[model samples]
Structure formats: structure tokens, C-alpha cells
Target: MRTDSEIKSDILEELAWQPNVDETEIGVVVEDGTVMLTGVLDDYRKKVAAEDAVKNVRGVKALVGDIQVKYGANYQKTDLEISKAIVKAFEWNTAVPEDEISVEVRDGWVNLSGEVDWAYQKDAAKRVAENIIGVKWINNAITIKQSIQPADVKEQINKAFLRSADIEANAITVEATEGLVKLFGTVHSIAEKKAAEDAAYLSPGVHIVINELEVID
Candidate 1:
């Protein structure tokens, strides 16, 4: 097992490798593979980039983001403007149902709440929120409501995990209730755990995937 100091050094190196993030402004501290990010960034996108960069590090178990979004003078937007921008942006996306999603902005943080039939649609809405320039943060509260028989959901997800090249099928377990699926097991990496969850979401009638897959690497 790698020491916390080794993990911290790797996270810093990962941060430096990310082109979008200003590594000098960020601080990282690790304890038993848990990483805490501090300091400030110019945009919400960069903050996200920093987190994404760190997650790819081998020893990182979990992340706590304490990084602040320090909006530059040119990037500031009123709540109404932010709401309007996000709404307009979503309108242009083919995968996202513009009318089905509602945008609420308070203090430059965007809140997206709506219902969509597919998990991908909910994810599309969140991507739109994340790319907007003035967005300090995003709360993707979009819910999925699909018409699928609950019994078939588990079988379908199990088959998918078996098919996926990245995931170890036997190590993971799946449970389904209505449209919600709960995953429990251990995986080799964060990427594999995400792949298992993606497989669960691909199964029809799945609205929420409660991923309890632990990364054992």
C-alpha cells in the first residue's frame, strides 16, 4: 500500500498535467487515500477539471472538494442571466428535452430539476450546466422515470457486467426495486466501478443507480 504522502505527490502531479486547471492556486492533502482539495479557481469548469484529474490517480479512495470558485470580473453573471443562458443552451442540445428541464439560478449556482425518460438525458442536462461560463456550481436534480418491469432490470444489468471488458462481473452485485438499482461490490479502479454503474443505467427501467462499488486498488 502507498503512503498518504506518495498519494498527495501524485495528485499534485496530476493537477499540473491538467491544462485547464491552474495548479499553483490549488492545495491537496491526503490521509489514508482520502484527498481534500483546497484553494480557489477562476471557473467551475476548472474546479471540476481538478477533481477529475485527481480521481485518475491510482491511490485516491475518495475526494472532498473545498475548492472555491473565484469568478473573474468578466465572468460574473446575475442569477437571471445565468438561468436564461442555461435554458438557451439546453434548447440547442438534441439529447436533452429543453421544455422538460427547468433552470434555477441563485447566486450564480445553477439548479436543474426535471424528469426525463433516460439516464443519458439527465446526464446531458448536467453537461450543459457545467459548460456555462458563469456557473459557480451545478445541482443536477433531474429525475428519471421510465416504464420498465422491475424483474427484468436485474437480469439485464448482470448480463451487461458480464459483457463489459473493464469490469469483473463476479465481484459486483446488483439489486433492483422499481426503477432504482443498487450496486454493491468491489472493483479494481474508479473507472471499472463507473463502468459497472454505466451498465446498470443502460438497463431499461433504471432511474437511479445507487453505486456502492468500492474501489479496491
Candidate 2:
């Protein structure tokens, strides 16, 4: 067992090893084994890595990441460029509905506000914003709407199979809404299950593909 201050110091020291993030930029507070991380990271990956590092540490009961991402002023990007990236994020990501989402950038911070049908889409939108060169932090204020029925989920799964080459479209069952495609039924192997998921991810409006297909022994 360690004191809160001791644990916080240890967490700060651990974050120093992460690339693209300086310890000076990181602030840690440990309250009864719950670690709260605060600081601005240059990229979202570094932020994620920082959180993961804290989780892997011994005696961490839970973690709260409040890492702020701030893009370098050295990187120059126009408002149009930021806007375009926001739109492209929606177009390329099947999970996010472009019509429902909105993006705004100010002094390197990206703010996203929208209503998505699932939690994953909100996550995806934030991820897209975090990937941009000048995005320092993302303020995601998106809401999750109602989900579709199980039958609708099956339809999405079938559509995913139909889009694939190897999988038998007729044999697979799908349940979908808000970009999460759940596949039910037997497949040849784990590889087939993965293949089905990959296909569904590439589908026009898919955010996540749940590979629920069981392996038949």
C-alpha cells in the first residue's frame, strides 16, 4: 500500500517514459487508488497511452483521464482545413452521422457537438478530431439517441455479409443500428469471423462490428 502523494509521484514518473508527452505537461492526483490524469498531450494516441500506462501500474483500482490535448502553435492550419477534416472524419467513419454532428476549432482545441445513435459514434468522432495535426484537446458534447431493434441489427449483419466475398450472406444474421453490427450464426473459423467484422466496418454506415458468431466445434 502506498500513500496518495507517493502514488501520484510514481504515476507522473511513469508518464515521463511515454513518447511525445513531457512530464511537465502531466499532472496526477491519486485519491484512494483512483488516479486522475491532467495535462495536454500533442496527440490522442499519447493521451491513450498515458491512461493505459496508469492502468497497468500496480494497485490502481480505477483511473480518470483528464488529459488536455493541445496542438503546437508551430503547426499552421487554416479554418477551412480544420472544417474539411471534421467533415472527412464523418465521411470516412461509418459510425458518425455527419448531419447530426458539428465541429468547431479555436486556438487548437476541437469541440464536437451532436447526437449519435450509439456511444461508439461519439467516441469515433472525438478520435477523428484528436488525430488532426492542430487539435490539442477535444470537448465532446455528443448525445446518444435510441437504438434500433434486434431485427434491424440482423439486417445490418446480412448487409455486411453481402458486401463480403467469402462469407455466405444467406447464412449470417445481423443486428445493427448506430454503426454497431452484430453477427450471429456459425462461420468457418475465427478468421471468417474476423473477416466478417472487417467487411462490416468498411460498410457505408458502420462504426463497430460485434463478432458474436460462435465457433462450432
Candidate 3:
């Protein structure tokens, strides 16, 4: 446990160490482990960097950043650039389903909605949206679809299993039904078990992976 003063000091130290931030330019207020940052930054990236610096601190309960940026006046143009940046980021990412996801911008706020096959894709979508300039906030309304075909699912699971060196292909039992893959087998360690599951997840049509594989001690 850390005292409020200790947490405040830690927050300030972290912010000072961040790239392009001057310690003298930043002011911090602490009340019961919640930090409020007040300062002026040269650009939007520094504004974001300042907030992120405090966010990753170990004892930080919450962050309220009131940092003003010189670029705030050009927010409308910034918003358009941010929207374009987010679109380009997703278009090149293989894990993201760009066709299923739609990015809408309103007053520098981004709203993302659509269906994706995995939880990782949902997280990735949010990250891309946040990196865009002029983005005051993001609304993530992505849904996950767990329905897929059995034969296609099975083939994908088999390919994933065979890709691993530790998985004894002959002993592995994989069954896919309605986009859900159920694995029943023995693996040497927990790492192998996780790898096997991840491999199945990367398959194009897989919606859910259920690992029933036993780990040997």
C-alpha cells in the first residue's frame, strides 16, 4: 500500500520521464490516489503521452487530465485525419475484420460497431481508434459471432495442431461443431496447451475454442 503523497510523487516522476515532457511545465494534484493533471502541451501526441504516463503507474487509482494543447483549435481537421488514420490502420491488420467493422466520426468522437470473431479483435479495434488524433472518446459496440461450420472448423483445428512440434498429431482429438472446437488430449505443459488453443483460434472460420486437453505434471 502507498500513501496518497507517495502515489502523487510517483505519478509526477513518471510524467517527467515521458518523452517530450518537461517536468516544470506539468502540474499535478492528488486526492486519495486519484491524480489530476493540469498543464499545457505543445501537441496532441504529448497530451496523450502525458495521460498514458500516469495511467500505467502501479498505485494510480484514476487519472483526470486537464492538459491543454496548442493544437486544440484545429480539432475539426484533426478529427478527419484521425478517422482516416484509424481506417488505414485496420485495413492493413490481418486480425481485424475491416468489412464487418464500421468507423463513424462525430465531433472528434469515434464510434465503432460491427461483429468480429474474437475478443482480441475487439481490443485491437479500440486501440486503433484511440491512436487517432482529435479523438476525444471512442464507443466500442463490436459483437462476437460464435456460429461457424463443423467441417471447415475441424480442418482448421487439425492444421493448427499439426503446426505445433509438441502436439502428438496421432493422439490429438479435435472436433468442431457449429464453429466451436473441442480438444481432448494430453500435452506436456500448460504452454503447449495454450499454444494449441491459440493455433485453432487463428483459423479463419473458428469462433470459439474449447480446450479439454489435459496437461501432464
Off by over 4 Å in 1: none
After superposition, the stretches of candidate 2 with alpha carbons farther than 4 Å from their true spots are 5-31, 34-41, 61-70, 148-217
Task: Report how far off residue 101 is in candidate 3 (Å).
Answer: 0.9
| TM-score pick, better of 1 and 3 | 1
Per-residue lDDT of model 1, residues 1-217, tens digit only: 7789998888888888998887899989899888999998888889988988887887777789999886888888888888888888888999899989888898988888988888778888888888888888888888888788877889989998989898899999898998989999898766677778888987767888999988776
Model 1 whole-model lDDT (C-alpha atoms):
0.86
Best-first order by TM-score: 1, 3, 2
Candidate 3 RMSD to the correct structure: 9.6
Q: What is the C-alpha lDDT of each candidate?
A: 0.86, 0.69, 0.72
Consecutive 10-residue window with the lowest summed lDDT within model 1: 187-196
**Which candidate has the top score in TM-score?**
1
Between prediction 1 and prediction 2, the one with superior TM-score is 1
